[model samples]
Target: MKYDALQRLLVEHLNSRPVPPHAAARLARVRAAALARHAQRQRQRVRLPEALGRWLTAHNAAARRSAWAMAMVTALSVGYLGWAEWRTPSEADVDIALLTSDLPVEAYLHPNFTRDL
Candidate 1:
Protein backbone atom coordinates (compact mmCIF):
# COMPACT_ATOMS: atom_id res chain seq x y z
CA MET A 1 0.00 0.00 0.00
CA LYS A 2 1.07 3.61 -0.50
CA TYR A 3 0.82 4.30 3.29
CA ASP A 4 3.05 1.30 4.10
CA ALA A 5 5.68 2.50 1.58
CA LEU A 6 5.54 6.04 3.01
CA GLN A 7 5.96 4.71 6.54
CA ARG A 8 8.98 2.63 5.49
CA LEU A 9 10.53 5.66 3.78
CA LEU A 10 9.98 7.79 6.91
CA VAL A 11 11.52 5.09 9.13
CA GLU A 12 14.53 4.76 6.81
CA HIS A 13 15.08 8.54 6.76
CA LEU A 14 14.92 8.74 10.56
CA ASN A 15 17.31 5.80 10.97
CA SER A 16 19.80 7.25 8.47
CA ARG A 17 20.27 10.52 10.39
CA PRO A 18 20.84 10.49 14.20
CA VAL A 19 19.29 13.35 16.20
CA PRO A 20 21.89 15.52 18.03
CA PRO A 21 22.25 14.71 21.76
CA HIS A 22 21.33 18.28 22.79
CA ALA A 23 18.28 18.25 20.54
CA ALA A 24 17.17 14.86 21.89
CA ALA A 25 17.61 16.09 25.48
CA ARG A 26 15.65 19.25 24.71
CA LEU A 27 12.85 17.18 23.13
CA ALA A 28 12.71 14.95 26.23
CA ARG A 29 12.56 18.01 28.50
CA VAL A 30 9.74 19.54 26.40
CA ARG A 31 7.83 16.22 26.50
CA ALA A 32 8.20 16.00 30.31
CA ALA A 33 7.03 19.62 30.77
CA ALA A 34 4.02 19.01 28.43
CA LEU A 35 3.16 15.81 30.34
CA ALA A 36 3.33 17.65 33.67
CA ARG A 37 1.08 20.44 32.36
CA HIS A 38 -1.36 17.85 30.98
CA ALA A 39 -1.47 16.00 34.32
CA GLN A 40 -2.09 19.26 36.24
CA ARG A 41 -4.91 20.21 33.83
CA GLN A 42 -6.48 16.74 34.25
CA ARG A 43 -6.37 17.09 38.05
CA GLN A 44 -8.00 20.53 37.81
CA ARG A 45 -10.69 19.16 35.47
CA VAL A 46 -11.54 16.34 37.91
CA ARG A 47 -11.88 18.76 40.85
CA LEU A 48 -14.84 20.61 39.26
CA PRO A 49 -17.39 17.97 40.28
CA GLU A 50 -15.96 17.77 43.80
CA ALA A 51 -16.10 21.55 44.14
CA LEU A 52 -19.73 21.58 43.00
CA GLY A 53 -20.64 18.85 45.52
CA ARG A 54 -18.98 20.79 48.33
CA TRP A 55 -20.87 23.95 47.36
CA LEU A 56 -24.16 22.05 47.38
CA THR A 57 -23.38 20.54 50.76
CA ALA A 58 -22.59 24.00 52.16
CA HIS A 59 -25.97 25.41 50.99
CA ASN A 60 -28.11 22.28 51.63
CA ALA A 61 -29.45 23.67 54.92
CA ALA A 62 -30.53 26.92 53.26
CA ALA A 63 -32.24 24.99 50.48
CA ARG A 64 -34.12 22.85 53.00
CA ARG A 65 -35.19 25.94 54.97
CA SER A 66 -36.51 27.65 51.83
CA ALA A 67 -38.47 24.52 50.86
CA TRP A 68 -40.01 24.34 54.35
CA ALA A 69 -40.95 28.04 54.23
CA MET A 70 -42.67 27.54 50.87
CA ALA A 71 -44.58 24.53 52.23
CA MET A 72 -45.70 26.54 55.30
CA VAL A 73 -46.89 29.39 53.07
CA THR A 74 -48.84 26.95 50.85
CA ALA A 75 -50.44 25.24 53.91
CA LEU A 76 -51.40 28.59 55.47
CA SER A 77 -52.94 29.81 52.19
CA VAL A 78 -55.05 26.61 51.86
CA GLY A 79 -56.11 26.80 55.52
CA TYR A 80 -57.12 30.47 55.20
CA LEU A 81 -59.14 29.75 52.02
CA GLY A 82 -60.90 26.79 53.71
CA TRP A 83 -61.75 28.91 56.77
CA ALA A 84 -63.10 31.76 54.60
CA GLU A 85 -65.33 29.37 52.64
CA TRP A 86 -66.66 27.73 55.80
CA ARG A 87 -67.41 31.11 57.51
CA THR A 88 -69.20 32.69 54.54
CA PRO A 89 -72.95 33.28 55.13
CA SER A 90 -75.61 31.51 53.07
CA GLU A 91 -79.02 32.65 51.67
CA ALA A 92 -80.67 31.72 55.03
CA ASP A 93 -78.53 34.36 56.80
CA VAL A 94 -79.52 36.90 54.13
CA ASP A 95 -83.22 36.09 54.56
CA ILE A 96 -82.99 36.31 58.37
CA ALA A 97 -81.11 39.67 58.18
CA LEU A 98 -83.70 41.07 55.78
CA LEU A 99 -86.60 40.04 57.99
CA THR A 100 -85.01 41.35 61.21
CA SER A 101 -83.61 44.64 59.81
CA ASP A 102 -85.32 48.00 60.60
CA LEU A 103 -84.35 49.40 57.16
CA PRO A 104 -86.39 48.57 54.03
CA VAL A 105 -85.30 45.57 51.87
CA GLU A 106 -84.75 48.03 49.00
CA ALA A 107 -81.94 49.71 50.98
CA TYR A 108 -80.12 46.35 51.24
CA LEU A 109 -80.57 45.82 47.51
CA HIS A 110 -79.12 49.24 46.61
CA PRO A 111 -75.76 48.97 44.71
CA ASN A 112 -74.37 52.11 46.44
CA PHE A 113 -74.96 50.64 49.97
CA THR A 114 -71.91 48.58 50.97
CA ARG A 115 -71.77 45.90 53.69
CA ASP A 116 -69.28 48.15 55.53
CA LEU A 117 -71.97 50.88 55.91
Candidate 2:
Protein backbone atom coordinates (compact mmCIF):
# COMPACT_ATOMS: atom_id res chain seq x y z
CA MET A 1 0.00 0.00 0.00
CA LYS A 2 0.99 3.68 -0.64
CA TYR A 3 2.24 5.82 2.27
CA ASP A 4 -1.04 7.82 2.47
CA ALA A 5 -3.19 4.67 2.23
CA LEU A 6 -1.00 2.95 4.79
CA GLN A 7 -1.32 5.95 7.13
CA ARG A 8 -5.11 6.02 6.71
CA LEU A 9 -5.39 2.26 7.29
CA LEU A 10 -3.21 2.54 10.38
CA VAL A 11 -5.32 5.37 11.77
CA GLU A 12 -8.57 3.46 11.10
CA HIS A 13 -7.22 0.21 12.55
CA LEU A 14 -5.78 2.01 15.59
CA ASN A 15 -9.10 3.73 16.29
CA SER A 16 -11.12 0.50 15.80
CA ARG A 17 -8.85 -1.97 17.57
CA PRO A 18 -7.29 -1.40 21.02
CA VAL A 19 -3.50 -1.38 20.71
CA PRO A 20 -0.75 -2.16 23.28
CA PRO A 21 1.39 0.77 24.65
CA HIS A 22 4.34 0.38 22.22
CA ALA A 23 2.11 0.29 19.07
CA ALA A 24 0.15 3.31 20.34
CA ALA A 25 3.39 5.28 20.82
CA ARG A 26 4.64 4.27 17.36
CA LEU A 27 1.34 5.46 15.73
CA ALA A 28 1.55 8.77 17.60
CA ARG A 29 5.10 9.37 16.28
CA VAL A 30 4.06 8.61 12.70
CA ARG A 31 1.06 11.00 12.93
CA ALA A 32 3.27 13.80 14.31
CA ALA A 33 5.83 13.41 11.51
CA ALA A 34 3.09 13.48 8.84
CA LEU A 35 1.58 16.66 10.39
CA ALA A 36 4.99 18.38 10.52
CA ARG A 37 5.65 17.58 6.85
CA HIS A 38 2.22 19.05 5.88
CA ALA A 39 2.90 22.25 7.87
CA GLN A 40 6.34 22.77 6.26
CA ARG A 41 4.86 22.38 2.75
CA GLN A 42 2.15 24.98 3.58
CA ARG A 43 4.71 27.51 4.85
CA GLN A 44 6.83 27.15 1.68
CA ARG A 45 3.80 27.90 -0.61
CA VAL A 46 2.82 31.31 0.91
CA ARG A 47 4.45 34.41 -0.70
CA LEU A 48 3.73 38.09 0.09
CA PRO A 49 5.16 41.33 -1.33
CA GLU A 50 6.31 43.92 1.28
CA ALA A 51 5.59 47.03 -0.82
CA LEU A 52 2.20 45.84 -2.08
CA GLY A 53 1.03 45.11 1.47
CA ARG A 54 1.92 48.63 2.65
CA TRP A 55 0.38 50.27 -0.44
CA LEU A 56 -2.88 48.32 -0.01
CA THR A 57 -3.15 49.34 3.66
CA ALA A 58 -2.66 53.05 2.86
CA HIS A 59 -5.03 52.96 -0.12
CA ASN A 60 -7.79 51.31 1.94
CA ALA A 61 -7.61 53.99 4.65
CA ALA A 62 -7.73 56.83 2.13
CA ALA A 63 -10.68 55.25 0.33
CA ARG A 64 -12.65 54.96 3.57
CA ARG A 65 -12.06 58.63 4.44
CA SER A 66 -13.10 59.78 0.97
CA ALA A 67 -16.28 57.69 1.14
CA TRP A 68 -17.23 59.25 4.49
CA ALA A 69 -16.69 62.80 3.17
CA MET A 70 -18.84 62.11 0.12
CA ALA A 71 -21.65 60.66 2.24
CA MET A 72 -21.62 63.71 4.58
CA VAL A 73 -21.78 66.14 1.66
CA THR A 74 -24.72 64.25 0.13
CA ALA A 75 -26.63 64.19 3.43
CA LEU A 76 -26.05 67.92 4.03
CA SER A 77 -27.26 68.83 0.54
CA VAL A 78 -30.45 66.79 0.90
CA GLY A 79 -31.17 68.26 4.35
CA TYR A 80 -30.67 71.84 3.14
CA LEU A 81 -32.95 71.28 0.18
CA GLY A 82 -35.66 69.77 2.39
CA TRP A 83 -35.41 72.67 4.89
CA ALA A 84 -35.63 75.32 2.14
CA GLU A 85 -38.66 73.65 0.53
CA TRP A 86 -40.40 73.37 3.91
CA ARG A 87 -39.84 77.06 4.73
CA THR A 88 -41.18 78.34 1.38
CA PRO A 89 -44.89 79.37 1.26
CA SER A 90 -47.47 77.36 -0.71
CA GLU A 91 -50.32 78.51 -3.12
CA ALA A 92 -52.68 78.67 -0.08
CA ASP A 93 -50.90 81.84 1.18
CA VAL A 94 -52.06 84.12 -1.78
CA ASP A 95 -54.52 86.98 -1.03
CA ILE A 96 -58.22 86.06 -1.77
CA ALA A 97 -58.98 89.58 -3.19
CA LEU A 98 -56.78 88.90 -6.27
CA LEU A 99 -59.04 85.96 -7.23
CA THR A 100 -62.39 87.84 -6.75
CA SER A 101 -61.73 91.27 -8.41
CA ASP A 102 -62.30 90.52 -12.14
CA LEU A 103 -65.85 89.04 -12.19
CA PRO A 104 -68.60 90.48 -14.60
CA VAL A 105 -71.19 87.70 -14.02
CA GLU A 106 -73.86 89.89 -12.33
CA ALA A 107 -73.63 92.69 -14.96
CA TYR A 108 -73.92 90.26 -17.86
CA LEU A 109 -77.19 88.77 -16.47
CA HIS A 110 -79.02 92.15 -16.02
CA PRO A 111 -80.18 93.68 -19.35
CA ASN A 112 -80.52 97.18 -17.86
CA PHE A 113 -76.92 97.27 -16.73
CA THR A 114 -75.20 99.10 -19.64
CA ARG A 115 -72.06 101.12 -20.26
CA ASP A 116 -72.40 104.36 -22.35
CA LEU A 117 -69.64 104.95 -24.88
lDDT of 1 by residue, 9-107 (tens): 999999998899999999999999999999997777557888888787888887979989999999999999999988998889989988998999889
TM-score, candidate 1, is 0.40
True-vs-predicted CA distance for residue 108, candidate 2, Å: 30
Compute the lDDT for candidate 2.
Answer: 0.78
lDDT of 1 at 50: 88
- Candidates' RMSD to native: 12.4, 15.2
- Model 1 CA deviation exceeding 4 Å by range: 1-59
The parts of candidate 2 lying over 4 Å away from their true place are: 1-59, 95-117
lDDT (0 to 1) per candidate: 0.91, 0.78
Best by lDDT: 1
Residues 49-99, model 2: lDDT tens digits: 855676678788779789899999999999999999899776665335335
Q: After superposition, how far is residue 32 of candidate 2 from its true place, in Å?
A: 18
lDDT of 2 at 75: 100
Best by TM-score: 1
